[model samples]
Target: MAARTITNRKARHEYHVDETYEAGIALTGTEIKSIRAGKANLQDSYARVENGELILYNMHISPYEQGNRFNHEPKRPRKLLMHKREIMRLLGQTREKGFSLIPLKLYFKNSWVKVELALARGKKKYDKREDIAARDAKREMDRAMKNRHRE
Candidate 1:
């Protein structure tokens, strides 16, 4: 199967992910086919605990072209299938401190759709800048090492 990525670009820029979980998504046949065709988007997607269950919101799965009126909504709030204990833990973490449920990536795993959810904290302006600087320094160091090896 061809590997595809549906990534939440803003999540990386906004939050520092502390942990990640892979959860199954409740998807219909048409939605699954559409995702297989690489027509899914996770740009603004997020997850929340509601009624003791995890629900995904703002995720856009494009409608299957061959589907008729039975096609699923592109932006529906889909349920995420996670264990009860995991859900409770996520709820506690999110409710307590700077943690939030953010969708990091969406992809097919063993022919099944899976969402990679991150427990993250929002980064401040200074933190973001520091991260950028650190990344730049790491890149420069890597380049220097490569040049030293070449010489």
Candidate 2:
């Protein structure tokens, strides 16, 4: 089966990602089921190093439709599994000013749920404007190139 991915589109627009890491997530049975059905959202989700562990906050995995009272919470803080050394390194990096851990995507990797986490710095308003302008220019150039090739 192909991998199903849930992405945080706003994360890229809001932050300048510097590094990325793949980490496993601790999920309950219902949560996994919900994710497999593409009922998950990574919007506004972020990770933080706390007491030697990396914890994910604000991730929303919708409750399974068939699940009853045992259904998992839609929004919960989940733990991200990574090596101690890596966690320590991330902690160190995040300690610097403006650096934060953001969840970029969630997907199934070989039957295991994996999270693509990024170490990023928040972008300023002008930076966002610049990115938008550059993207518009790139789009126009691509359109021109496509027309030229077709002509």
Q: lDDT by residue for model 1 over 15-86, one digit each (tens)?
A: 999999999999999999888888998887789999999999999989999999999999999999999999
Best prediction by TM-score: 2
Leading candidate by lDDT: 2
Task: Assess candidate 2 and give its lDDT.
Answer: 0.95
Off by over 4 Å in 1: 1-3
Predicted structure 1, TM vs. truth? 0.91
Which ten residues in a row are the worst by lDDT in model 2? 1-10
lDDT of 1: 0.92
In model 1, what lDDT does residue 117 have? 99
Q: Can you give the lDDT of residue 140 in candidate 2?
A: 100
lDDT of 2 by residue, 1-151 (tens): 3547999999999999999999999999999988998989999889999999999999989899999999998888999999999999999999999999999999998899999999999999999999999999999999999999998
In order of appearance, the predictions have TM-scores of 0.91, 0.96
